[model samples]
Target: MDLDALVGRARSLAGGGATRTVLGLAGPPGAGKSTLAQTLTAALGDAAAYVPLDGFHLSNAQLDRLGLRSRKGSEPSFDVRGYEALLRRLVGEPAREAYVPDFDRSLDEPVAARHLVPAGARLLVTEGNYLACDLPGWREARGLMAEVWYVDAAADLRDARLMRRHTGFGRDEAAARAWIDGNDRPNAELVERSRDRCDLVVTSLAG
Candidate 1:
């Protein structure tokens, strides 16, 4: 939880290589993966760029067609192949500018080109729920990262944060609880199983 120390570590990763290095943060939902990614990117400024896995969420139409609407945030609900391709491009073409996608909680959909990894960015910070997963496309994506960190937090705290997120995004309290119990909890359990695969385990991040 030492802010300055974490910043120094991230800076080292940024400068550690000739090609752009990628630092991945993997954790269950509501474990503050995005918060830590943003903190590092902000501290490093132009030297860092961010790409979030939420951007690869399947559209509602596609979810419905695939009969996965009820399990929207599950692993199979993401376009893992596209995410892997983007990461590959970032690692392979360090000199090129790459547009990144993001998920809009307000619209509950993925938006294209919401972020940019400009040429000369020495580090690319990407965060997601499945970076450490041993599955096919996820495994390929993980192989491209210089390091992967597992962010951890109390389950109760995560549940509270998730409830607020769901309600803030239009779900009623009751519906949010139901969805969390039915969908998010399972996803988190699956994600937690990959914790041992990460290079580091982050218990918390300094604000």
Candidate 2:
């Protein structure tokens, strides 16, 4: 994958009219969507901003109350309506500065206003596991994007990355494997089904 070419494409997206253009990155867990989105935003500097869907993760308390702790990363575990509203605000109010939330892996919680989309930003780069999902709330979010890119990676590579991520965040190897099999794998499969709905497929950043 040519990083320069990808940057060039992002630059083109940032060169549009006064209305903010949202570029969404959709992929399964550990597919490098966040990495690519951050890279593009960094390269574009003030012209681009990033918003991640992981920010809409329901709190652990909410998950436990709803009996969804074991399925924490699943579609139902997210506040999809909140995510949709954020996207709508970002697209509808380009001239206004907006605060963006983010999920903190260290705290294993969602933090409020960890990022800001400045009024000068012309392009907004958002990435997540379910951006291309065909579900009701997700479909509304996708409709606001100027384009969505499906990030892809090899199964083995994704599994390896997920294992590292889980263990790094306090899960034991056995627990990590079980969670991946029970939760992440199913979510990945569901996201894969929506790949055809994306405007582009991105494998360049998979590595």
Candidate 3:
């Protein structure tokens, strides 16, 4: 679907007495969830705000302590409960502004309160891999969203994009490939299994 169509549907969910209408974009790694979230937020102007669940990525230190640093992007490496609480605040307290953390890919860490959702924003866009997962916190997160869209792409294309991202963020070519093959691909498979749970399935998003 076109950007306008997506915006229209999101807008429709925000009218009348609604407090905050959340449009969830769920997908496997490299499926363009971040791209769609940014595009929709920009297209919707001040009416929309973005809160990525990636912002809740556990710190590298915490990951090391948990012995999960090698599998950083996996679901267990995130602060799922924290992300869920932030979602609740977005929909529950419409009259108050919410400060949201942002994930810095360059630093591979989460920066606190880097983005804010103003009280006037009618729509909130949240994107992540686990939004539609049937796992504990994810199922509750899915229930919190007004609508969920599953972003998808061909496997080869997705793998290529992920490799580029990993290298750009600092890994060497071989390390990036190993991480993608061993860690990311498994997480992608887990995410894809929940595709049918989303309200819509979007194969490709425009540049």
How big is the positional error of residue 48 in model 1, measured in Å on the Cα after superposition? 0.4
What is the Å distance of residue 5 in model 1 from its true position?
1.7
Q: Between the candidate structures 2 and 3, which one is better when assessed by lDDT? A: 2
RMSD of each: 1.4, 1.3, 1.2
lDDT of 1 by residue, 157-179 (tens): 89989999999999999999999
Model 2 vs. true fold: TM: 0.96
**Estimated TM-score per prediction?**
0.96, 0.96, 0.96
Candidate 2 lDDT score at position 177: 99
Backbone clashes in each candidate structure, one number apiece?
A: 0, 0, 0
- After superposing candidate 2 on the true structure, give the runs of residues whose Cα lies further than 4 Å from its correct spot: 15-17, 204-207
- Tens-place lDDT per residue, model 3, 1-207, is 777888788788763455787889999999999998988899888889999998999999999999999999899999999998889878989888989998999888999999999888988999999999999999888888899999999888898899889999999999999999999999999999999999999876733
Distance (Å) between predicted and true CA of 98, model 1? Answer: 1.2
Model 1 ranges with Cα > 4 A deviation? 15-18
The deviation in Å at residue 201 for candidate 2 is 0.9
Better of 1 and 3 by lDDT: 1
The RMSD (Cα, Å) of candidate 1 is 1.4
